[model samples]
Target: MAREGARPAYDPAGHDTALRATLQELRTGRWMSMRRLLTETTAWWQWTRRTQVLATAAAGTDVVRTWLEEEPHSVPATVMHARVCVERALRAHREGHPHTLDLWHEAWRASHTATRAAPPDPVPWVCLMALARLDRERQWAEHRVAPPGPMLPPGPWGLLAEADKRDPYNREAHHRMLQFLYEHGTSGRLAEAAGYAHWAADTAPPGSALHLLPLYVRVERYRRSGGRDAALDLHWVAEDATREAQRALYAWFEQTFTAERSLLDLNHVAHALWGALQFTDATRLFEALGPYWTPQPWAYRTPDQGDTAQAVEIFLQARARCRPA
Candidate 1:
C-alpha cells in the first residue's frame, strides 16, 4: 500500500529542483537522517515521509549501489529512499519473478552517468544470475543488430534447441520443454530432450530431486520414441541413479519419488511405475493425480483441527493456480 503523501499546496516553480536537492541531501554521502531532511522541507513533510519509508526498505549496499547507478531520475529524498525500492525488488525476485533482476539492474545503471565499471568479483548468486541473463540478452540483440550478415558465435547453451536447455531455478520450464517434445514425438526433439536431461543431470547436485523429473522426462521420451526396451533402460538408470539404492526398488515411484508418476495413484501398480508415465498415460493418470495433488475432499482427515484445514486450503489454492489452462 502506498503511504499518503501531500501534494504541493502552491504552484512553486522550483518544486522539481527542490525535490531533487532534497533527495541528494538524504543520500549516502550526505548522511543526513530522514527526520533531519524533512525538517528543511517542512512544507513537503508527507513527501519526505514517503521517501523515508521507501529508502529504509531499500537499505542493502548492493541495493543502494543499484539505486545510485540505475535510477538516476528517481525522485528519492536521499540514497536511502532509492535503497527501499531496491529492497522491494529483491524480495519480489526471491519469491518468484526472476524478471525483477532486470528492473534493478536497469535502475542501478540509470543513477550514474559515468561509464560503468565491471561489478566487483565474488558477486552474489542473484547478481551473477542477473549478469548472465544480461549477457544472454546482449547476445540475442547482436544477432538482430546486423540483419542477416555473419551470425554471432553462440553462447555455451544458446546453440542448444529450446527443448535441450534448462534454467536451474525454473523447474516448470524444464518440465514444459520436455512435455512438448514428448507430445510431439519429434526425433530431433527427443535427442534435444536427452541433451537437456543430461545437462540438467550433470549440473544438479548428486541425488538432487531436480534430476528425477528430467530423468523421467528422458524415460518417457525414450519409451515414446523407441519401445519397452527404452522404458526398461530408463528404469534401470533410475534404480542406479538414486543415492538410496535399497529404497529405490520400492519407493512409491510416482507420488513419493522425484518423478512421481501421480500424486494419487489408483492402484499399487500405478504407484510402482510412478516415474514411467508419458503424455498419453499422464492424462489417464490425472484422475488419480488430482485427488492427491489437488485439495480434494477425501484427503482431509480433519476439517478444522490444528489449523490443518487452513493449510490444506492454501495448498489447494496453489494447486488450482498450477492447473492446466
Candidate 2:
C-alpha cells in the first residue's frame, strides 16, 4: 500500500526495511528469527517498528492462521497471530466497527494461547496488557464507565509484571504500563506521569532507550493540552522540565548512538527540542533522523490537523529552523 503524502526530502521509506524483513520471517514461521527480531527491536526501543510490523501482519491474518494451524507449537506464529488479532481489534474499535468486541475477544483468546505456548516470551504478555488497556479505553468511551479511579484494574498490571519478569528492561512493556497509568490515573495529574518517566529513566541502565520516557510524557502533555502552539509556548525552553528532558535526550545521544538507534526515539526528541526552541539540539537529532519522519509528535502538533501534509510541514519547518547559520 502506498503511504500518503509527499516523502520527506531525506531518507524516506521510513527506514522500515528491517521491519519488513522481520515480518517476512514471521510469515514463514521462523521462530528463531521472530525471537531475535523481537529481542533486537525491543532492546533498541523500536516500538514503532515492532508495532508497524505486527499491524501489517495482522492485515493478513488468514495466512497467519494457516501457519499456526500447521505448526501449533510455533512460538513465532502464535505470538504473531495474537499480535495481529489484538491490533485488528484495536483498529476496529478506533474505526467504530460493529464487530469490535468479537475481534477483541478473539484477540484475548489468541493472546492466552500464545502465552501458554511460549512460557518464557514477553511478547504475549505485552499483547495481553495492550488488549486490557484498549478494552478499558473502549469501555470508558462507549459505555460511559466512570473515569478510571485510584486503582487500575489488576489484569493489566499482572500482565505487565509477567512481561517485566521475562524482560526486565523491555521498553515496549514499560511503555504499555506507562500508557495504562497515564490513561487510568487521576485526571490532570501530569506530575504523576512525569514521576513515572523519571523513575523509569533512572532505573534503566545508562544508554538504555528508557531515557526517552520523559519525552513521551511531554508529548502526551502537549497532546492533552490540545496540541496548539500556545500549549508548546506555555512550557518554556528554560523551564526545569525542558532542561531535564534535554538531559535525557543528551544521555541517549551520548551512550546509545549506534547504527541501530531507533528512528522513533530520534523523531520524538527532535520534536520536543524544537518545541522548546532548542534548535541546535533539535537540528542534530533531525540530521540523525535524515528525513525518516514517523508521523507522530508532528502529526499531533496541531489538534484535529493530522494529515500527512501537516506532518511534512512540521518536519520541514523544524529542519529549517535548525539549519546552521
Candidate 3:
C-alpha cells in the first residue's frame, strides 16, 4: 500500500511483509531479525522463499557470515550460509565472472555442508541444484545423471530428488532445474526444457506452485525467441498457450489461499491470462495482486524484453482491461 500515485510501486519483497522488514534490518547489518523470522517459519515453501530473498540481500553483506560466526552449529545459519553462497555463484555465473569456478566450488561445498546440517530442509538441495548452471560443461558425474524420461537431458537429477523428498513439488527446485536446462540446451527451442516443464506440471499437486512451471517455460521460450516478432504474438493466445494459462489458473490460483500464493506466480498467471485474452478470468488475479507487480512478464508483453517503463505501462493497461464487472 505504498502511496506513490495510482500504480503500486514494485515491491521486491513481493507480498511478504515480514521478509521486507527483515531485509531492511539485514541491509543495516542486523542479523537478529532474520534469525527470528526464519526460526518462526516452519513451512518448507515459505522457508525457501524467505531464504532466497534474504540470501539476495545478504549476498553483498556480511550478515549471513556474521550470523554463522556467532552460531556455528545453528542449522538456520548453516542453511542461510549455503543460500548466500549459492546466490553469489548464480550471480557470478550470470555475469560471466572470471572467478565463477572458485565461487561455484565454494558454493557447492557450502551447500553440501548445509545438506548434512539440515537433512530435512529442501533449501540446501535447492542450493546444490541452483549452482548446477555454473557447471556448463557438466564436468561432475552428478550433473550427468540420466533423466527419468526420454525428454530430459542429463542433469543433477539426484539433487532435484533430494530436494523433492524434503518438499514435494517445490517451486524453486523445479525452477532451478529449468535454469540448468536453459543454460545447457543444445538447441534454440529448449525442447528438453519444454518437455520437462510439462512433465512437472503433470505430476504436481493441485495446490502446489509447480502448476506455474509450464507458464514460466513458455515465457522463457518466448524470450528465447527474438521476442519482437509480431507473428509470434499469436504465441500467447494459441490453443496451447491459453490452455496452459487456464490450467495454472484452476490448479494453482483456485486451490491455494490468497495469503500463501507466491507473488511472482500470481503475476505470471495474470500475465498469461491477460495475454491469452481471457480478461474475465484474469480480473481476479489482478485484484489478488492489488498494487504490486513483477516487471518481467509484463515486459515481455512489450517489444523490448526488459523494458520496465513500457512494462509498467502495459501492466497498467492490462489491469485496466480486466477490472471489476
Candidate 4:
C-alpha cells in the first residue's frame, strides 16, 4: 500500500500503468502502443479488460478505424475494431443518439468479424452479450431465450454461454448479463438481478471473482433507491449483507492475487466490510487498494451522486476508521 493517510485518486485504468499509457497514446491517435500491449496480453482476463478499456478511448476517435485502414489483416486490429464498434453502439444507445440502430448493426457485424478472426477469444462473444442490452424488445430470438434455472428471467443466455464456452465464468460476460438483467427486470430493487448474482456466486469456484457479484447488485439497489436512505445504515449491516461481504472476502479476495483484483471489486468488498462493521477485514482490502480508488459503492452511499469530492470524503472516513495496526 502507499504511505498511510495518502488520498486516493480515481483512475479508470486503475493500477494498470500500461493501460494508462496506452490511453494517452490513443488520445493522440496512436495505435502502436495499443498493438504492442495487446500483443503481450496473453491472459484472457487481461486481454478482455484491456481491449474493453482501450475501446472506450478508441470509440471517441478514429484511432481504431485508422489502425484497421493501415493493417486490414491484423487480427488485434480486427478485434479492436469490433471493440470500438461495440463501445460506440453502447454509448449511442445510452445517449439516445439518432443512429443507434445503425451503430448497433455495425457493431454486430464487427463482433462477428472479430469472433471469426479470433475464434478462441471470449471477448467477441462478450460483445454480443453486451449488445443484448440494446435489444430491449427482444427482436432477436436469442435475446429472449429461456433462463437456465428458476427466478432468473429470460435473456441472451446463449450469447453468455458462448462466452462461457471460451472462458467459463468470465467476469465481464457475467457483468454484461447482469446489466441486461437490470434493464430487463424492474425499475426499483431488482430482485431478479440479485437472484442471478447469487446464483452465479454460488456456482463459482472459491477463488473466482463471481463471489463479489452480489455486492454489485446490492450497490445497484442502493443506487436506484435515490441514493439517500434513513435505513441505509441498517441495510449495510443486515445479516444478508454481512454474509455476502464475508463470503467474498474469504472466497475471492483472500484466495486471489492483488494483480487479479479489480479496483471496483476491491472497493466494494472493502466498503461492504466497513458497512458490516468488519473493520479489520476491511483494512486488508483498503491496503490492497493503496492509492487508487474507484468512486462507486462509496458515491452511492451519499445523497449527492457523481460528486467525486463527497465520495472521497466517505472513502477517507472509512479508511481512517479501518486503519490497519
Candidate that scores best on lDDT: 4
TM-score of each: 0.25, 0.79, 0.96, 0.96
Instruction: Give the range where candidate 3 is weakest over 10 consecutive residues by summed lDDT.
Output: 1-10
Sorted on lDDT, highest at the top, how do the candidates line up? 4, 3, 2, 1
Scored by CA lDDT, what does every candidate get?
0.35, 0.68, 0.88, 0.90
lDDT of 2 by residue, 201-303 (tens): 8778877778889888877877777766663666646586577558757677777754546666778888778877788777778767764767777877754
Candidate 4 lDDT, 215-259, residue by residue in tens: 999889888886666777688999999999999999999898877
Better of 1 and 2 by lDDT: 2
Which of the two, 2 or 4, has more lDDT? Answer: 4
TM-score ranking from best candidate downward? 4, 3, 2, 1
Query: What lDDT is reached at residue 227 by model 3?
Result: 76
Query: Model 3, range 83-116, lDDT digits (tens) per residue?
Result: 9998898888889899888999999999999989
Greater TM-score among 1 and 2 belongs to 2
Q: Which tens-of-lDDT digit does each residue in 1-325 have in candidate 1?
A: 0011211121111223444454455455443343454435432222423343335433543444454455454333233433354445545555767777675665344322111221211112112222232332444442113211122222222212221222232333334334433433335545645555555544544433334444354335443444335334455336443322223223223324322232222222222233332323323333333334322221222234335455355443333332331
Query: Candidate 1 regions off by >4 Å?
Result: 1-168, 177-189, 206-208, 222-325
C-alpha RMSD (angstroms) for model 1: 18.7
